[model samples]
Target: MRQSTTTIMDSQVNILKYNQYFLPVNLKVAKTATTLNAKGILPAGTIIDATGKVVNDGTAFGIVYENVDFNNSMGTENVSVLIFGFVDASKLPTAPADAAKAALNMIKFM
Candidate 1:
């Protein structure tokens, strides 16, 4: 995923659409990337991590997601980031300057 794609403070978190491994908004959620032939779905109110990480709460039923990112091809170099933590809307770091901007913009809308 391209870092710094959006601008939202604490709101630019990405969703794990389909089944692509992605960084969790927070670090408490469990994330896993899968390679499926068709679009997958996740149940609403699934309590996903800030970074779109799904928590392993003893659930196995996958919900049907409608977003387009989930269907992204998952093959060689299809790796995605996963993270979870206390989200900060105004704290921007330098290591991921791109993501910092994207996240700030995203939070602005939230």
Candidate 2:
């Protein structure tokens, strides 16, 4: 059986100045086997896996905007992520449109 976890990183902040076209979204991400630093930034252009977990090897869903990890425990945390429409092209040039569509669908259900 797979374990499902949700982690909250940061509260909503003003991102209008950065990308007027996109909105910042809060997502529940599962903690990986790797250790995460407290108040660590996930950086922009982070890819999210199909299960809604942030991963290095997965479809590009959104760009993280200096999100900080609040939970120090080896679990999940809620993090702020910016979707494709708002992310700069330089971030993920090869991001698939289908992936963005899929992410939007997932977010809608969430």
Candidate 3:
């Protein structure tokens, strides 16, 4: 009988998102998450692209989802959710044209 071995390598920072795991610039699910409900990774210091005027990559500017301040009731219901994800500083409409690069302007909803 003969034995074989396989190896996988990665350099991207680990992140969690999309009910799946990803390694920055990559959206493939990890082998261990085959049966898990959510298994994804997001690279730190990374942003999702939102400037279609500049590029059409889904991996654009940083995107995130968060629910801060539960005081504001959308339907008279007292409920709140946490926040997550990444965004770029420029993509933010409120962000000045010359805004710094260390900021997020996009978001995702959970």
Per-candidate clashes, comma-separated: 36, 6, 23
Off by over 4 Å in 2: 1-18, 33-41, 54-58, 70-74, 91-110
* Cα distance off (Å), candidate 1, residue 65: 11
Q: Each candidate: what lDDT?
A: 0.29, 0.49, 0.27
lDDT of 3 by residue, 1-110 (tens): 54645333234322334434222222322223222112222223323233211111343343222111212213221111112443333433233222223232233322
Find the 10 residues in a row with the least total lDDT in model 2: 101-110
Q: On a 0 to 1 TM-score scale, where does candidate 2 land against the true structure?
A: 0.45
Query: What is residue 35's positional error in candidate 3, in angstroms?
Result: 33
Q: What lDDT tens digits, residue by residue, belong to model 2 across residues 1-110?
A: 55656676556433234444555677766666223444554434455554455544336455554544534534666666765344343444234355554654432211
| Off by more than 4 A, model 1 | 1-39, 56-69, 72-110
TM-score per model over all chains: 0.20, 0.45, 0.19
Model 3 has an lDDT value of: 0.27
